[model samples]
Target: MRLSELSVGDHGVISDITGLPPEQRKRLVALGLLPNTPVQLIRRAPLGDPIQIRLRGGDLAIQKRIANCVEVCLK
Candidate 1:
């Protein structure tokens, strides 16, 4: 499944980030969202364009477009 498809409060592990642009992929990796790393969907904006995720001890607000680029597996 894609990260954007995960429900709020759900946990999932990153399976692939290669689907994203090189710069975006690098940015996410630096944010600790690497393959095999677990992440939780914390919340989403009212319109849902941006979603909050928890991973590696930090929370990041990622755009839905970017979120969709992240492949994930449910934990």
Candidate 2:
């Protein structure tokens, strides 16, 4: 499933990141979102513009449109 489809408190391992340019992929990796990393869904913005995820000892918020491109497997 895509990262955007995960619910609050859910945890998953990233399987792939597609449809993004190299720079974008590198940015995500720098944020500790590399493939195979486990992440947790924390919450979503009230307006749903972005979703908060817990990773790498911190929380990071990502736009839903971008989240949709990240495929993950439940952990």
Candidate 3:
């Protein structure tokens, strides 16, 4: 499922990042978001716009639209 569809506390491994913009895809990759990498839904904003995720020893915040581009296999 799309990363955006995962609820807080869910864990998964990234599967596809081809749906993101070229620049964004590169940036995410640099931060260890490559395919098969493990990820966890940390939290969400009060309005649920941006979602927080933990991966590769750190956390990153992703917007709703961008999150839709991240495909993951839930664990």
How does each model score on TM-score?
0.94, 0.94, 0.92
TM-score of 2: 0.94
lDDT of 3 by residue, 13-75 (tens): 999986677998898888788899999999999999899999988999989888898899999
Best by TM-score: 2
Q: lDDT for model 1, on a 0 to 1 scale?
A: 0.91
Instruction: Please estimate how well model 3 matches the true structure, expressed as its whole-model Cα lDDT.
Output: 0.90
lDDT of 1 by residue, 4-72 (tens): 999999999999975677887888888888999999999999999899999988899999999988999
Better of 1 and 2 by TM-score: 2
- In terms of lDDT, which candidate is strongest? 2
Pairs of residues at least 3 apart in sequence or in different chains that clash in candidate 1: none
Model 3 TM-score, all chains together: 0.92
Per-prediction RMSD in angstroms? 0.9, 0.8, 1.0
Tens digit per residue, CA lDDT, model 2, 20-63: 99999899988888888999999999998699999878999999
What are the lDDT figures for the candidates, one per model?
0.91, 0.93, 0.90
Question: By descending lDDT, how would the candidates be arranged?
Answer: 2, 1, 3
Name the 10 consecutive residues with the lowest summed lDDT in model 1. Answer: 17-26
